[model samples]
Target: MTMTRKDIGLATRRAVLGDAHVARAQEATTAFDAPFQDLIAEGAWGRVWTSEAISRRERSMLTIALLAALGHDEELAMHCRATVRTGASAEDVREALMHVAIYAGVPAANRALKIAKAVFAEMAADTDQTDSEKGGDHDKG
Candidate 1:
């Protein structure tokens, strides 16, 4: 069966953004923002992210760079966290932000880097906690 745009978008958004994040966003949505959320799910996540022209990793890099260039710090941080699911490495993020430094200016890149660092740290910590809870000693032999 052919998937609807909302179906495609919801799946794409969850894959890229993670179920926890998407669930939180859905929970936080109000009547005023519900339509806006649907629009992004259909347009950005469905149309853009599901495009075959680029890999999800490439899209993650581009999204991060664009968010940084536009000084969208919150979205930049969210995308940085989403990179864990998108397979966009920290090195890729560094390179993308380097481009941002030259084209979007040093200030924007600097702020983005700071945000990326914090987000990475948070992700690492979460991973460590999960591993520990699973009885895995990730830090030991």
Candidate 2:
């Protein structure tokens, strides 16, 4: 049976990425992009992401590599953002970039790395903001 938009979005977001990453996506959604957001959550995250054949980790690696190969910086950044949910380590991402360099060319990999670095920095800043809102207790303990 087809799932409701809310359910599909929630499930797909959580399954492929994770609750934290999905929450960020939800927070960033705007009225203009709401429909596009829903479509992707259901189609990309829900349908494709929910598939059982490939593990999330493997999917993440494949996604990063493919996006880089195609020089699809935007999608690469998106998948890089989702890597946290897919259990992909920093090392794993680095390995994927290295492979992209070998197969896709250094220029493609370089651009992807730039996007990935920016995305990662943004994620870190978000985490810091959240921590500060919670009283910056993470640093104390």
Candidate 3:
């Protein structure tokens, strides 16, 4: 049977990473990129990211490092956000960037670090917002 877009997305996401990570990706995908997201769900996520040859953590590190090396700041930022769901730590990102600095050049790593820092800050703000919402709910109850 042909895989539906949602099915492809669900399986691809869960296989490459985890449910939480995929959920965030789905949430972050905007109206502008919804079509692109669908394409990725079928092409990248469905075909490649679901491969069993590598672990999710390894995929996360490699994806971030490569994106940084290639100067794909937006993609790097997206992957960095997904790293949280992939069970990667900030320390892992630091180590990856250090390697990128050595292998990919200092300038690339520098830019990647700046991008990651901003993404991380945004993530922190999102978390704080969620916590505040939960607090508001508790107060109402």
Best prediction by TM-score: 1
**Residue pairs clashing, model 3:** none
Single out the weakest 10-residue window by summed lDDT for candidate 2: 9-18
Where is model 1 poorest over a 10-residue stretch in terms of lDDT? Answer: 132-141
Counting clashing residue pairs in each candidate, in order, gives: 0, 1, 0
TM-score: which is higher, 2 or 3? 3
From the highest lDDT down, the ranking of the candidates is 1, 3, 2
Residue range 1-141, candidate 2, lDDT tens digits: 876865875787776666777799889999999998888877777777778899889889998999899988877887898877788976788899999999989998898888888888999999999878788675577
Residue-level lDDT for 18 in candidate 1: 89
Q: Judged by lDDT, which candidate is best?
A: 1
- Model 3, 45-71: lDDT tens per residue? 776676779877788889899999999
Enumerate residue pairs that collide in model 1.
Answer: none
Q: Which one wins by TM-score: 1 or 2?
A: 1
Residue-by-residue lDDT tens digits, candidate 1, 81-113: 999889999999999999999999999999999
lDDT of 2: 0.84
